[model samples]
Target: MFGNDVRLKLKMACRLLGGQKSVANSAHIDNSNFGKWLKGQPTLSEENIQAVLTAMGLPDGEPDTKNIHCWNIKNSFLNNLSSALSLYFPYTAEMARAPWVVQGPSLKDTLGIGDAPNTLYALTDGKTRAILRMPRSVIIQENNVLPVIKWRNDTPEKSVLLIEEIKSGWVTGVPTVKEFDLAWNAQGHQVTDHDVLQAIKDADISNKEAVRRIKQKK
Candidate 1:
C-alpha cells in the first residue's frame, strides 16, 4: 500500500505540474531517479525529499516528535513532518493552488466524455491534462450514490473493501461510477484537492474513485 500510495502521489504530482519533465526539474531530481523513487526505491537522500516537498510548494519544516509512531523514519519528527507535508501539500493541493486552470473529470464523467472506458482526466492549471485511467471492470453501476461515511480517510480496511466491492458490484452488473460526495451541497465551492487525495489514499480508492466522488452532485 505504501508503494501504491507513492506511485499515485507521484502521478498526481506530475499531472499537477504539467508534465514529467516539469516535475523532475521542480523536484530537483532526474527522470531516472524520479522513476526509481516512485517504484518505492529511494535513490536520493532525505535532503532530496525536502527538496521535492519544497518544489511542490508545501511547508517543509523540522519533524515533530509527537507524531513519530505513525511514520516509518528514524526521526519521528521528520517522519511526522513528511506525513504532514504529504497530506497538506498533496497533488490535489498543488493543482488547486496552481496559477493556471486545472481541469479534470468530476468523477461522474470523463472530461465531459462518455463513460464507456471509464477514464478520468488529470488536468493542470496550465494547458495540459492527462487521463488518469481506471479499470472499467471496477464500476458497480452508474448513478449509485453511496453514503460519504463509508469513504473516510482514517480506516483503510473499509475504504479498500468499499472500492473492491464497488468493482465487484461492477463486475456483477454494478455501475462503474458511484456518487459519493453528497456531503457537499453546492457546486463551484472550495473543495481542496489535498483533502480529496488524502481521503482516497486513506480509503485506498483508485483515482477513478476520486474523480467519481467529486463529480457526484454537480
Candidate 2:
C-alpha cells in the first residue's frame, strides 16, 4: 500500500509540477527505476522516500508525532484511521453543510496511548474539528488524563483526545479524534498544524529554545 500510494502521489506530483521528464529530474531517479519502484520491485531505498516527498515540494524532515493531525504513517494506518473517522463523524445532510476534509498525521507518535507508528486525521465543521490518532504502549496502561491535558493545554491550536483500546487484558491502539479550533491562528497568522509540525521537524533547536521560539511566535 505504501509503495502504491507513493507511486500514485509521485504521478500526481509529476503532473502538478510539469511532465514525466521534469519529475524524473526532480526525483533524481530514472523513469525506468521509478516505474520499477512503483511496482513493488524495490528499486529505491527507504531514504529515497524523502527525495520523492521533497521533489513534490512537500514538507521535509522527521515525521512529527505531536500534532498527530499531520503525521504521515503507513498506508494501512491511514486507511484504518480514515474508516474510523468516517464512522465517528458520519456525514449527513446537516453535517455535510461543510465540505472539506483536512487529513494528515499527528506530531507525537503514540500520544502516550498504545504503540508506535500510529497515524492521525482531522475533520472540520467549518469552525473546528477533531484531532485523533492511536497512542503508545505505555500510555495504554497508565492514566490517560495526563496526555489529554497536555494535548489540550500545550496544543493551543485545538482541543484533542488520546484514545486506546484494551481487550482481553491486552491493549491495542486505535485512531482517535476530538474537537479543535480549526480556524484559530497564532499571532494573527494562519498556520496549519502541518506547518507547525514541519517547522518543528526541520528546525534544530533545544527543548528550551524550541518552546521559547514557538511561544514568542504566538
Candidate 3:
C-alpha cells in the first residue's frame, strides 16, 4: 500500500522512530542527504524508498514485497538451524559453539553491507561471549570472526536447505551476487551464486520430502 507520496511516508517513519537521524541511520541514508530529504530539497528514489521500508521494519508496504520474501527465507534459515541443532541434542550444546546469523554493526561491516550507524543485534550469551571469534575474510576488513555451528549426524538434505536459506537471505537482502559468491567461497563452497541458487532450487523437491520423512521416522 505504498502510495506515491515519499515525503509523507518518510515523515511518518521519522516520527515513529523519534527523529530524522534515527530513521536515516536505519534507512542507510547518510547525514548530509538525509538532512536534504527532511528539508524537502530532494526526494528519495524508488530503490531508496524500498531500502527505507526494509530498514524501518515496514515491509508490509508494496515496495517491500521482495523484502517480505527475504524475511521469510531468513525465518526458514532459523527454523532449519534449530531443527538441525535439535537433532544434535546432547552432543550439541547451545552453549558456546552454536553459530547463528545475526544483525549487528560488526556483522554488517564484516559482510560489507555498509554502515548503519548502530548495532541492531548484540551477542548476549555469556558462554558464547567467552569463546566467539570473529570470522576472517580476505575481502572484509572487519576482524569479526565467522561463527560456524558444528553438529553431528547431519543430513545432506538439511545441509542443502540450510545453505539455501542463508544464501537466499543475502541474495534478497544484503549482498551483491559477487559478494555472495566470495562469501560462500570463503566458507569453502567454491561455487558461484548461480550454482548455489540452482542447487537450492533443485533440492526443493524429493530431497526435502525425504528429509521430512526421515525426521518423522525419528
Candidate 4:
C-alpha cells in the first residue's frame, strides 16, 4: 500500500489534473494499472513510484546530493527574515517516528527550513506541500541556532537571498519555489493557481480549456 502522505498527494494531484485517467496518462501508465496502484491491488513497485512522482513534476525526493557544503537555491531564499518560514524537508524512514507540523503566516515566514533536534515542518500552498531539510552545521545565524533573515526593503542589496550574502543560510530544493512564495516580494505568484502546468497533466482537454474551466470556477 502507498503511504498515507503519498496517497493523499496522489488524490490531490488526480483531482487537480482532472481524474485518475489523466494522471495515469501523464505517468504513462495504463489506466487499469494505475487504478490498481491506487487501490493497492498488487501494490506499487518503487521504480513506478518514482515515475509517477516524476510525472507530477515535483522536486525529486532525494536531495540532489548529501554534501552539506554544496549550495542550494531554495535555502538561499530564507536569509535576513525575522519570522517563521518553515520549508517541509524529507525524512528518509525515521519520519514515521516524528510529528508533522504545518506552518502558516502566524507561524512565521519563508521556506527552505533547516534541521532540528526533533521535528520537521510541512509547508503547503493549498495545493502541494514541499518538504525540506538542511544540516544544522551549515546554518549560521546572526544571534544563534536559527538561520539569519532580513527585510530586503531595509537595504535592497543587504537583505538579498544569496547564500554568500546571507547573514546565515537554510536548506533548499526546487528552483521554482519563489513562484509560489506568499511572502516578501511574492515574486513567485500572487494571483491564480501557480501550479497550472502540473495540474493540467494528461487531461485530454486543451490546456487552455482546462485553464478556462479552472479559472471560471477557481
TM-scores, all candidates, are 0.30, 0.27, 0.24, 0.30
Model 1 spans > 4 angstroms off? 1-3, 61-218
Alpha-carbon error at 4 in model 3, in Å? 8.8
> In candidate 4, what are the lDDT values of residues 55-77, reduced to their tens digit?
55443543222122112122323
Name the runs in model 3 displaced over 4 angstroms. 1-6, 63-218
Tens-digit lDDT track for model 3 on 90-200? 132212111233322345555657522211111111111111122321111122212323311132112211133344333234444344333333333446878755765
Alpha carbon lDDT of each predicted model:
0.36, 0.38, 0.36, 0.38
For candidate 2, which ten residues in a row score worst on lDDT? Answer: 92-101
User: Where does candidate 4 stray beyond 4 Å?
Assistant: 59-218
Summing lDDT over every window of 10 consecutive residues in candidate 3, give the lowest-scoring window. Answer: 68-77
Candidates 3 and 4, the one with greater TM-score: 4
Question: Better model by lDDT, 1 or 4?
Answer: 4
Sort by TM-score, best first: what order? Answer: 4, 1, 2, 3
Worst 10 residues of 1 by lDDT: 93-102
lDDT of 2 by residue, 93-180 (tens): 0111111111234334324333433333333433223333333211111122222122222332332322222221112232322222
